[model samples]
Target: SCAVALEAVRDEAGLGRTVAQVRSERERLTAQLRGHGWRVLPSEANFILARSSRSVWLRDALAGLGIAVRDFPGNEHLADALRITCPANETDFARLTHAIDAALAPEAVLLDLDGVLADVSRSYRRAIVETAAAYGVEITAQDIARAKALGNANNDWILTQRLLAQRGIDRPLAEVTERFERIYQGTDDNPGLRMTETLIGDRAALERLRARTRLAIVTGRPRFDAQRFLEEQGIADCFEQVIALEDGPSKPDPAPVRCALERMGVSRAWMVGDTPDDMRSARAAGVVPVGIPAPNDTREEAERTLFASGAARVLRSLDELLEVLPS
Candidate 1:
């Protein structure tokens, strides 16, 4: 995900701009990791796991500093590494830097790309709008709002039908779908589209975390799209594993998660995401579920819903998860 953000930063925000404007700040952090002499990993999660030099004894060092980084037992490949969640702000970064300086030895890192890297909403919204336009129907903000109210199931088709109906052009469902495909293909790169501010922190956090762990991207997004996004960001080399939707069933189903765990040789692992689906998916896969609330969701509502749905715990932020997990 950070790789996606870095690409977005260069593509949308131009070069050499600090305070990355996009919701995901992958580019900023990627720059930082490269500067720090760490071999950054590709990621799909908001956090990353970096492996320090064997000489450094990173695990013992962090433990000595009173900072606990996530390390799952039973995964030999990941045993010597530390998993770090991306911080949301500059102040958090400062603390993270301090911790890194104290704990790690300069070395290669592993990273996840999900929450820590890309801010997907803006791209997703633009993709939706473009898809709608392909069907010869004009979608308005209200139409989008209505679609959102219905959740992911109704997002594409419902909005397309409503817009077409508003135009007094009732077409067959097949034709509408065909048109949607056409529009989406053409308008996917509209310059006006962008992710929200909440996503900006992802990239920045990844770069910093890279200075510490080995990274991989384990996501429910299809492999084709995920790879394209990473290539665009110029950080594809950072990750060793690029697990995508086709790799297995989508989240809330244990297939993909278990597949990732198997590939990474990770027996004990932490799953982080904004929705209850993330937590549920992790639990279903028998991994630890770390819930990071959506920016728009109420804290109390998130906790109640996630906890009721069987989350091990609900976190206010990614940084909080770092605090709760065993070092």
Candidate 2:
């Protein structure tokens, strides 16, 4: 068959044309990868080897997206490299690079659990208030808002501890957390404040948004809490992945957001959250940061903190993201 095919295009003109086209695409792909910060090596063959820390991960991610790239994970010298074969035409080449972009950049929607997905005013916020009162510190909603604006209060337990400290009531973190979780999760015989939670956006609307883009959770909640909330809300399947507290450092550190993106196997994404910490994390992870009003914050305060922390847009409702997402 190889001999027959060669004979069919045996003419020097046809052979030269094919060789020129392949060489052109190979050069184009190399240039494109280099422009995107990939350390692409000079190639005289059918594929280009590009060095990236994401080489192993990208190989797997692209495979999931139905594209193939070779990674030399077992080779000491090439373990950090991916060898991408050049596509034969401009259209396929365009597709190849687009997939690469999606893997290397934010391409999905990452969500914050407490404020954005579930209305936590009656749940987590109430837990904070009740827990502080137990420690003899009467912190108001405004105080919580102020604390959140600091961009390091993603952990409600820690926030409660800090609020107590501000009131001259320095409580042990373990003690404060014990009380906070008890109130939030409740005992087997008692209903917890978590029951007060409700979905911020309608199920149908979320489904619509999910249909339009990939969805995932990047929350400060422990994996158990996050999972329970999603399951109880009957929306567990809406997101592709969940990056919980156990995954890494909480919001404002960018670790959780990046973990979520990496788990989803795409780099580019938009993150919708309500706290300054959420905005900062998304921005640091190179994801578009969109903000919604925190349950305990006034619109003015929400706007001020969210924007200052790097929110590209502040939305009135989660559903508004459908309007904001690019078509």
Instruction: Please list the Cα RMSD from the true structure of every candidate, rounded to 1 decimal place.
Output: 20.5, 14.4
Worst 10 residues of 1 by lDDT: 103-112
The number of the candidate with the highest TM-score is 2
Q: Write the per-residue lDDT of candidate 1 for residues 57-133, one digit (tens) a residue.
A: 33433333333558766877765555666655666565555545423322222222444355544444445566566
The CA lDDT of each predicted structure is 0.52, 0.80
Candidate 2: 10-residue stretch with minimal lDDT: 57-66
Candidate 2's clash total is 8
TM-score of each: 0.48, 0.68
Kindly list the per-residue Cα lDDT of model 2 for residues 155-216, writing each as its tens digit: 99998998888889888999999999999989999899999999877779789888778899
